[model samples]
Target: MSQPLSVPESHPRPALIVVMGVSGSGKSTVGAALAKAISRPFIDGDDLHPKSNVEKMSRGQPLTDEDRFPWLAIIRSTAERVCAEQAHSGEVKEGDRPAAVVVCSSLKKIYRDILRGQHAASTKMPAEEDTSEKHPSGAHLPASPALQTYFVFLDGTENLLMDRMSARKGHFMKASMLKSQLATLERPGEGEDGVARIDIDATPEEVEGAVRKAVKDMVGM
Candidate 1:
């Protein structure tokens, strides 16, 4: 059975947590685990990508911003919906509480800005209105609160990343893409709010604990 999207708990405010990095950065695994641990919904940003996008990556073609724009829209809209719904329910009095964790590449600061802009626009609109249709798929998503976004940057040595990618099967992303991703990644700097970096060598449990603490600290949960 598919998991329900919005978390059931009474959140203080809606948060838009982005667990992001290159392909082998364990975004999906860590995102899902963290969500389960926190009792919040996890949205795999990769699954939101169109098949054509995956195909391009499988062919080792790096995606240009034009190609990635629509995919980012889908992810932003999904997170917006969760935040809007929770905020509208009146459970979260503050407008900045994060409602869910969205796993995405979020490679560049520009991409992060775009995601933030989308949510900011959504939150500014009236709750009864649906602005999500303006996005890529033109799908209607609920209005979200002022998003408290967090960035979890997963990093490791190039050799380690390649090994992880090489071992994986059935995925569209190839080990060959690792070098490109590593070269392209723009690591978040200290000034960025809610940013945390974890060495990929850490155990899954350890990573989860760090993420939980980060989320709790951000939301005061």
Candidate 2:
């Protein structure tokens, strides 16, 4: 166990946390736990996948980048919307932390960059700029604050991941596709911003604890 990270008197709002890993790495489970621990909402990236993509994966086929583009866009928009809602709600005070945890197999650097709002071609609204103010009509608009994105990569041995995937029921992904996912995975480098790596060998509770600590360290929480 690690020492608790200190929470500053004042810190930024709208912490967008992506719990990322290969399938069966416990991303959804750990993401839900982390969200509960941090008092944030959890969004499962699987729910955002298109029907075609789901059907293909169910047949044990791996998704191409083109198949994933729209799905990733949806996830990005969902996170942005959640953060915007938190900013509008009066629940967050000066020092209070507002966050959303999303579970996704963000295996590639380009995918992670899209989630971080760093992609120039992203269709999602800009995080820092308030487009609502620009509109003359007072229709409710989504306006996210400057996002502070964090990645919690749950890494594990191939055998463990395959075992877990085999135990899973009613999922579109097949255990046999684990190799493809591992091949696609691009571990965050030392210079990458706001990334934390956790060994999946730990119990779910312990993993969640580590995730919370890593997020706190990332956001000065």
Candidate 3:
């Protein structure tokens, strides 16, 4: 195992992590592993998607932005609540700590902006479909916490993802929709913030190790 990254004393607040990528990219598995290593709560982004959306995907339909809007709202609200509540009370539930490790595809930059708004309302980040000329920070939410937000992008070739989807069983999403997902996928670029993009070329263990190391290094854990 690689050594954990050491956090700087001046860093503020626990990280709000989003394990993101297209379906079959192992967001849940890797996110859970990262949460375990960091000792934080893991909130699966899949759980936040509405039943209707799941049904549509299962039926091999690509979701329109309209279909994703409400689901994204729920994600943003939950994240906001998590950060704001902890910042207010400084106490975690039961034996848990204050940090949250959330896993969501967060495909579009606009989707991420919506989540950022939840962290601080003063930053009026654009809505998912609101891909106007304005940047994410252009709209500010002051109420949002200043805590660091980390995003992990699980990446692989289309063939690899398709093969994994075919091998997996009983998932709410169907293999038929894999192509649609691939078509809709938006890979992370260098300009995105708090993003740790991992290319999955080796074993799952290796991918998990890279993610763990990225988080530790990014957050100075």
Candidate 4:
């Protein structure tokens, strides 16, 4: 049998890490780096958004709460799917799980709560729809598999973020929307669990190094 690779720490695995921030905060870069550091798979939350949401964002319009719940639901489902897939992968041994990382803006507390598999105020969710899954016959199925969800909130100054956004080429999100995104962001609270607030006011290599270390420490592994 092949030997297991060694890292500085060992996380419990089955952890869904949401690398979150507004536009140009380097969610994708940092998320990918963290996944590499952990030897896990990474998914970009932007790819989970519905086509309508993509079009809206491309037009430089900010999404309303109505436009976000469906997207967040997709993220939540994908998180569980990623962990399940990794758990059954060839390299994973019995009784061991793997972590999954994804990039998401998750600008509001309600959004973050939804990602954590917690129900938020009804007004925030789509009308008459909850996070539960249903069968083809509309029967209520069991809830999703339990996985530890964590957030790596990338915090930075508006000017710094704006500069990064402007330098990007052909990204769906526009630099003009950065102001609104900053306005929409809700920083993690002191009481929030499993969160790592990362400051991104540094170079990519520097920020990525911080992200890797922060995740390692936050996992306490």
Candidate 5:
């Protein structure tokens, strides 16, 4: 299900917490912990990747833009579906739409833009469509925009992250491709909206605590 797309103007937006980084940066680790802390659902973005993409990664190949766009769309829709279901269940406050924390690489600016509901060349899809078509006479128009997405970047040096990836087991993304991802990564720019970075030197418990505090501070969850 698609998110409502709009909420009351007076209401604070529902948070879409995206934990992003290249492989082996503890994205799923911290995202799951944060989702539990906030009583929201957690989604592993790799699970949303297409079979072909997964296969390519397993073969130690990198995904190109053409390969990533559709997968990114799935991630956005799945997260929205979770948010819509949470809102429909009435478990959350009227306007305090519940959040969904997701782990994604979101390597490029365009990739992150897709998650943010922004359009780029050839990236146009449902995110650019109007919700008015779903309602009579556009009555449900423009009250507000909820499910605002915020990105938490897991920052670490290539050497450190590479060492961690090499020691991991059973993941499709090979350690050899870490440099490819790091090269592609455009670390959320200074002008980027709702972007924050992590302190990788901290312990696991400390990292989770820091993520929770950052999400709350950023989205008031």
Candidate 6:
């Protein structure tokens, strides 16, 4: 196993890490563990969902893009706030780089763009174009102190995901919706920045360790 990465003494910028995957991919479990290991705050994206969206998912219905826009907005705002707070805290030590981990599906490329402060119109650009260079959407984005975002994608076989979901209880998201969630997922491409893909077949501890190592490599921690 690889050793955990520590923030360099000279690096003070706080990073925003998004743990993403379809339901039952251990996003929440691994995300929380990663945050604790890195000494950062953790936010569960499911808690930011609107009640209507929750109800729809509880009924085993997939949420439309419209249903997700508002929830995604909330997550963006919350993450930006966390980043701002870290930035203003003043003279953070290298090992104490005030990072935050958000457990979000971020299954779509467009959603990740929004979190990264890109305009929605950029989504219409050709796949080869650098959408990150596009103008800001000026919608649902914080004013300043942009957070450098990283993504940790947890992937596994559908059968394993289904079995995990079946064993989970008391969640609004139903196991039946896993198929739709998987279909909606868009794996991060090479052009996308700061993305780490990890296989979920390993134990939760191993998964978190891999995620930490990936983040360290991405950010030069």
Best by lDDT: 5
Clashing pairs in 1: 13-97, 14-97, 14-98, 15-97, 15-98, 15-99, 83-144, 84-143, 84-144
Ranking, TM-score, top scorer first: 5, 4, 2, 6, 1, 3
Q: Give the local distance difference test score of model 3.
A: 0.66
TM-score of each: 0.73, 0.76, 0.70, 0.77, 0.80, 0.75
Show where candidate 2 strays beyond 4 Å.
1-11, 50-62, 122-145, 169-172
Off by over 4 Å in 3: 1-11, 50-62, 84-97, 118-147
Residues 1-221 of candidate 4 have per-residue lDDT tens digits of: 12222211232446778999988888887888888888778888877666667779889787877788767766766666656556555444555556678899888998888788766343243445443332111112221446678899999998888777777877666665677788888888998998888889888899898888888887642
Q: Encode model 3's per-residue lDDT on 1-221: one tens digit a residue.
A: 12212223332454678888888898889889888887666787667665667779889787877676556555554554454455445444433334678888888776776555442333332454342222132112233344456788888888888778778877765766677677777776777778888988779899999998998788665
At residue 210, candidate 6 shows an lDDT of 88
Please tell me which model should have the higher lDDT, number 1 or number 3.
1
* Model 2: per-residue Cα lDDT over 5-118, one tens digit each: 222336355677899999898888888988887777899887766566778988978687776755666566566656555655644566567677999989999888767765
Candidate 2's TM-score reads 0.76
> What clash count does candidate 1 reach?
9
Candidate 4, residue 148: CA error in Å? 1.1
Error of 5 at 15 (Å): 2.2
lDDT score of residue 96 within candidate 6: 57
lDDT of 6 by residue, 14-48 (tens): 57789998888998889888877776778988776
Model 6: colliding residue pairs: none
Compared with the true structure, what per-residue lDDT tens digits does model 5 show for residues 1-221? 32344434434556678999988889988988888888889988877665667779889786878878766766666666567667667656676756789999888888887777655344433343443342223222221234578999989888888777878877666765787788888988898999888877678898888877888788787
Deviation of model 5 at 196, angstroms? 0.9
Candidate lDDT (C-alpha), each: 0.67, 0.71, 0.66, 0.71, 0.72, 0.70
